[model samples]
Target: MRCPYCGSQDSQVKDSRPAEDGGAIRRRRVCPDCGGRFTTFERVQLRELTVTKKSGKRVPFDRDKLARSVETALRKRPVEAERVERLINGIVRRLEQSGEAEIPSEEIGSMVMEALKGLDDVAYVRFASVYRDFREARDFETVIGELSRPARSAPDDGA
Candidate 1:
């Protein structure tokens, strides 16, 4: 790795450890030329995935963009930062595991709505408003109504 301090081309790793989140590797290195120490992180890159918009336009899937949308919905909410990070990570992992080169944008929006629905009702409504393109207040009422409904129980058979 190149040293940031002296711009040296050679550096030796002095220590290596797994990052706190276990998502990356942290390495402590020292430049042989200047004896300057620095840290670096390494992470695995998943295969590139494309997002197919409603207009039939294709674009690369962006995690930061996804996070920003979710964060906007969750703004001023009571949800913890860690929980939000986990939620984003979970959604990204699911998309990656689908093993599809291209996925519909609507599918991604639906996934975010589902995740937010469980995280915070207000956030869910906020995200749904934008995702569903709410034309009137009644649209929110409809979604809120759906969220308010009790889950159906399985029908019992004579045992």
Candidate 2:
């Protein structure tokens, strides 16, 4: 790795460890030329994912874009950055586990909605408003009503 302090091509790794979330490798390096130290992080890219939009356009799946959407909904909310990161990771992992090279944009929106719903109800409604393209206040009311309902359990069946 090139040293940022002196632009030296020669560097030695002083220490290496897994990052906080275990999603990346953190390396502490020293530049021989400048006698400077720096840190680097490495992450693995399993595969490229494509997102199929409603207009029939296919684009590479962008984690930043997904984060921005979620963050926008979470703006002014009490959700923490770590929680958001975890939520994004969970969503991406689910998409990857589906074993599909291409995924519909609607599916991505639904996944975000589900994640937000569990994290924060206000954020969930905010995301649903934009994602579902709410045309009137009634749309919000409908979703709120649905969320307020108690989950129904299946009837017991004797074996």
Candidate 3:
């Protein structure tokens, strides 16, 4: 790995172990030239993904960008960090397993919305406002109403 500090091209791994519940490998490395130490986490990619934006532009999938968007929604919320990590992992797994090399950006957003809806209500609304492009107070009210409503019960089959 290249050294982040001195931009050296060489580094030595000092330690390695499982992280993120064995979803990734964490390596502690030291830069030989600058004597700088840093940690890196490696994850296995099932396949390279391309996100097809609404504008018909395709961009390489970015895991960090996904994480950042999730974190932004969960910001200042009471949800635990571990849960957030799992949520992101689950979303990525689903995307990778979809059997498509390219995925629509809307699909990704919907996945995030579904996951957040189950994780935290406030975070769900926060993400929805941006993802759905809420333009008026009525938009917020509509979403909030959906949240407040109880789940529909199964229709009673007469005994």
C-alpha positional error of residue 124 in candidate 3 after TM-score superposition, expressed in Å: 0.8
RMSD of each: 6.2, 6.0, 3.6
- Candidate 3 has which clashing residue pairs, if any? none
Top candidate, metric TM-score = 3
Candidate 3 total steric clashes: 0
Q: Candidate 3, after superposition: displacement of residue 40 in Å?
A: 0.9
Q: 53-73 in candidate 3: lDDT tens per residue? A: 999999999999999999999
lDDT of 1 at 19: 66
The candidate 3 region of ten consecutive residues with least summed lDDT is 150-159
Candidate 3 to native Cα RMSD, angstroms: 3.6
lDDT of 2 by residue, 1-159 (tens): 999999999999999998739987999999989999999978665778999999999999998899999999999999889899899988988998889989999999999988998899999999999999999999999989868765444653654
User: Which stretches of model 1 miss by more than 4 angstroms?
Assistant: 1-20, 25-42, 150-159
- State residue 94's C-alpha deviation in candidate 2, in Å: 0.8
The backbone clash count of each candidate, in order, is 0, 0, 0
| Deviation from native of the Cα of residue 76 in model 1, angstroms | 0.6
**Model 1: lDDT to the true structure:** 0.89
Best by lDDT: 3
Q: What is the C-alpha lDDT of each candidate?
A: 0.89, 0.90, 0.95
| Candidates by TM-score, descending order | 3, 2, 1
